[model samples]
Target: MDDRPNPIDRNLLGIYLNDHLAGATLGVDRARTLADAESERDPALADAVRPIAEEIAEDRAELLKIMRRLEVPVRRYKIVAGRLAERAGRLKANGRLVSRSPLSPMLELELLRLGVEGKAAGWRTLRRLADADTRLDPGQLDNLLERAHRQLDTLEQLRLRQVSTTFQESGDRPVHQESHA
Candidate 1:
């Protein structure tokens, strides 16, 4: 039996993994930011976010381990790009005075939710391929999937509450008098 692994496998996996790492990195930052911002508005929500952020960070480390096992080198450029992209996300237009804008946290929560959804799909894909590729474990992927689901739920609930309180009845503008200056 030809034991040579498919060359396509490593290339595809490396690309996907690099992208996955980007989302995980962004998710880690966004989750922590959300938790910190919510501390003033909703202490309980902030408290709930700390553990999720910690877990996601741990999962990112696990991704590095998986990449190492597959002999796939991490594209450091992608990591740098992801960091830049997240910094750009922080610069989004959010009407504000001098203090931190409410839009900041709300937009971040939405991004975090989207990132978790992406992570869930990535885990499911890995789980399906685990049988063919010995580098991955289905059980570990399942655990990640479950965690992603929980994180998604939390973000959705928080996003809705934030939307309700931040937006006006018109739902187009901030409830607070925005400084157009």
Candidate 2:
């Protein structure tokens, strides 16, 4: 048996936890600062920070997995934060558009079978469809539908932001509209 502890194992199981936590916190803090600074100087840079924050969050999760595999208990705070960070990363990956552009007839039929009807009911219906496999409770279904709606709202916000940026960049000139005589 090797009496000497593996340096890599010691580093990963010991110093790595402290360093990972510190690095995650510092990275997020620096990203926030950079975003604030760029908000005034360069909106693009501020937008860029969103992706950077997401990357740091992903890195943090990978580190957590390694810690878990080593039989080390990660702090509860870190675990919770990692979950939230993973969610944020997922939302970023999903992009800005929720795309409510007409469900397929088959999907619509499925929704009707699930007892959901009419517009604005698509999300709830879709949740029902998903719950078929996931076996989510009623409350869970409600929460999932709420999240879907929130995602749609995020898309709307992004669209509005893009429009505002375009207007500002175009010197506030209204787009040319043709009139039919």
Candidate 3:
């Protein structure tokens, strides 16, 4: 039996993989930036985020390996555009001009969490394809999917932690809340 994907299927797969690759690139860049920026001011957040950033980069590398296995050509322009978009995202106002806003960390964590969710979806899609595609390893996809789930859980914990840091006062009351009790 011929194990190769048909030409049309291969072409479509190439496009899909490249799109996800672009997103992965952006995710890696954003995760790294967030980790580095948080290092000094929020050492605990930095500690929590640094490993996730590393895993994100590793996941991007894994995607590249998967694309190579599937014979999908990397779209260099898409990668470049993804990087540029990540940089552009930094320009959005977080209610501060020069100094880093308290909201920045929380918002960045939320964005990273969303990216991981997308990545997990991609892993699931590939896992589904693995049943028919010999070039795709089900074991590898399973591992990647599991790691993505773990990353999602970690990001959520970090993001929720950021909520109080960003919005609450030293007394544990929300910044905007008035005394009622």
Q: Which candidate would rank higher by TM-score, 2 or 3?
A: 3
CA error at residue 21 for candidate 3, angstroms: 0.9
Q: In candidate 1, what are the lDDT values of residues 127-180, reduced to their tens digit? A: 887867877888888988898898888878888877865665546753444335
Task: Report how far residue 101 has shifted in candidate 2, in Å.
Answer: 46
lDDT of 2 by residue, 38-98 (tens): 4544466468555544554554455455446545565656645644653453333222366
Q: Which 10 successive residues of model 1 have the least lDDT summed?
A: 170-179
* Candidate 3 structure quality by residue, lDDT tens digits, 10-55: 8888888888898999999998898888777787898899899999
Name the regions of candidate 1 deviating beyond 4 angstroms. 1-8, 168-181
The TM-score values for the models, in the order shown, are 0.82, 0.34, 0.88
The C-alpha stretches of model 2 lying farther than 4 A from their native spots are 1-12, 75-181
Best by lDDT: 3
Alpha-carbon lDDT, every model: 0.79, 0.42, 0.88
Output the worst ten-in-a-row residue range by lDDT, candidate 3.
170-179
Ordering by TM-score: 3, 1, 2
Instruction: For model 3, give the RMSD to the true fold.
Output: 6.3
